[model samples]
Target: MAHLQPKTIVIVGGSLGGLFLGVALKQLRKNLNIRVLERNPTCLLHDQGAGIVAGQDVQEFFQRHDRTHTPLAVTSHQRLYLDRKGNVIDSEDKQQHMTSWDLLYHVLRANFDGVDSEYAKAPEPQDNEGTAVYGYGHQVGDVEIDGAKPLVIHTTTADGNTATFEADLLVGADGPSSTIRKLIDPSVQRTYAGYVAWRGTVPETAVSPAARDVFVEKFPFFHSNGVQILAYTIPGPHGAVAPGTRLLNWVWYVNYAEDSREHVDLMTDKEGTRHHVTLPPGGIQDAVWTHQKEAAQASLPPQFAELVAMTTVPFVQAVTDVISPAAVLGRDARVLLLGDALAGFRPHTAASTNQAALDAMALAEAVGRIVEGEDAAEVLGEWEARVLEYAREGQRRGVEMGQRSQFGVHPLRG
Candidate 1:
């Protein structure tokens, strides 16, 4: 009888990239054990409501990893740019689709059901012993990576239990303010863009008949000027709803002045209940909402103005910039950075999620090759090279677009 060699993998941050990687690797390794450490108590995971347009890279990856819940298409094969007055400036041939963050999360979660029979007939049982596991309410306290069998992850469980686990590999799938990254390399900077975003969704039922008619009739509507706004219908829990019942999502960017910093910080209310804070949230201050209302009345379109007024809970995020050290701490062979953790891109390109999906597939292939015993570090190094090249290119492009957007020169100048 042959004994099975054990392989343990720890992923910090149970968000998109982390979960996607865990599930993809589990499906591939079949023998490696996987665990995800997510800080937010399970209750706060679904509060975010922004929508993302998945590119070919993401679409193909989701199809391969977990096809069960790929969202039903919600975009109209068109990309329209508009002006501040809600007038069209130029249109493009970009065929894009929109899906809410939560919807995508649900689809990914469903794929991890570990019950293959549902998606396939006599589907080769996913390694019954091999599992892709999720641990909620576990906050990562600190991380220390030693040579082989490195990566000591200190965590606080949901039940308030403290424990430390070690793994061969550690990934910071954590978002903008990743604690792991901070411990690994403190010099990496997260710069602010002097802007803040107020994001929220209004159900089809909440929106007025007129607003619904306009949103459904058109896919994404944009408004330019220093105040930028983008709105679209995205997949929600009840399936794609009718115009009035569809999920209408919006992200509004407001430039920050020296005195107005508090306006952005005030996104959270007093009860430690974050209505919106880039990283911290409990409750929002009264004056912040007052300022937001005035700004909406003055800068936003009539439809958007109404939508903001309609939303019961709006999230505010103070925009910040984050870029990893040119020299990521890993051996540069098997461990690599992906998504926002690698090269943080502004929202202008709407390519963040797409980038992450691309990372998952790329990493999977690299790991597959590593399993074949062909120099794990070498394979990973090559992957990092490719990621860095493309990520830097994308970042450059995003910065250009952001600058153009600020000056009202972007194609959609709306």
Candidate 2:
């Protein structure tokens, strides 16, 4: 009997979601060829300096996949709510783990492509694992899928050179603006949540002793009409988690009416580019930042206000929600969407990264079953049902949380 050919799996978008799925699948099967295409030309992605709440799934992902013993997060020992007057109004002992986006990305990249960085050093590849490739500067332009046939992908390089490749399975882990998602189902669209998060980070060393005393070791929050702010410590530059080395990350969600002048002006960068989703650090215009700082000072607790004032470069991300009609696509179910490509939850629930981790692990298990002589279509169908439910529930909860926090509207009583 002749041995079957190894399957080719292609993943678009090399961010957390794609890397998570790529690493998980690579670890499980040796008779596979995996390629992760990243649009960014540089090997290293810019540090967003944003904090991620390390939910249970995120921790479990690291526990199972991370080979590096390096520390990854800072611990918040309690939930602290501050009144507008800067006095503690409510406090509860609740521990939560926080990590930086840079830290997580570097760690996952190292594990997936055996790349060494300041945050994580890659280990030797296991002999049982398949070939894994990370291609940067490859922008996917088009895709073609046919019934029970290998999928075709066309990509264009930075220099405009085009290339085509074939894959037995295509995974769309690309984020909210995923080209794959558009190709799969254009009807589904992301709906803006009528607000934006003003985000910034201050190094622990830069924060005043008084502010540190109030925020350190605590997950702090402040809520008022039409706005909500939260802060926590996360690993600093290059994954530093030591007491004095970590960074204080804060996010203030403020309402902005769609197409309003304030919204339009805030989303416009210094370079005159209009950003739909995010205005990156240093890209925010001076006037916008100044006005936002004024708003922060007037509305926020003193400590929170001080943190915003101390920030050198602030960023903004428009909150949005999206849930795809289906997770598994294509006539053969060989095409799939994962992570933000499948569902983008509002940030209020802090479930975005957790959802990605969960999706990756669940798909890995399903793939494992398929590798063990199980039917691929049947296994993937079951996986799709499970993940869709998870994503929908997360999306619903995030929207509810956003509603309650931003508008003070509780869920309707039956």
Stretches of model 2 off by over 4 angstroms after superposition? 1-6, 409-414
Q: In model 2, what lDDT does residue 87 have?
A: 80
Could you tell me every candidate's TM-score relative to the true structure? 0.85, 0.96
For residues 1-414, write the lDDT of model 1, one tens digit per residue.
011122667777777877677767777854777877788787326546667776777778777876464344476555556555655566665556677676566556666534332212112345443766777788888776454545678898878899887776677778767776776666887776766777777776677766665565355456556667767777655445344446777878767653354653564465544433263322456566667777777777667787777766677777656767541455322134667777677887777777777776777676666655666656666777777776777778777766666555554555
All candidates' lDDT scores?
A: 0.65, 0.86
Candidate 1's displacement at residue 384, Å, is 0.5
Q: For model 2, where is the 10-residue window of minimal lDDT?
A: 1-10
Candidate 2 local accuracy as lDDT? 0.86
Model 2 TM-score on a 0 to 1 scale: 0.96
Model 2 lDDT per residue over 186-296, tens place: 888888988999999998778777788777878888888888888999998889888888899999999999889999999999989999999988998999899989988
Top candidate (lDDT):
2
Candidate 1 residues lying further than 4 Å off, grouped into runs, are 1-6, 70-72, 83-85, 113-125, 205-210, 217-224, 238-244, 258-265, 271-282, 326-328, 331-335, 407-414
Q: Give me the displacement of residue 322 in model 1, in angstroms.
A: 1.4
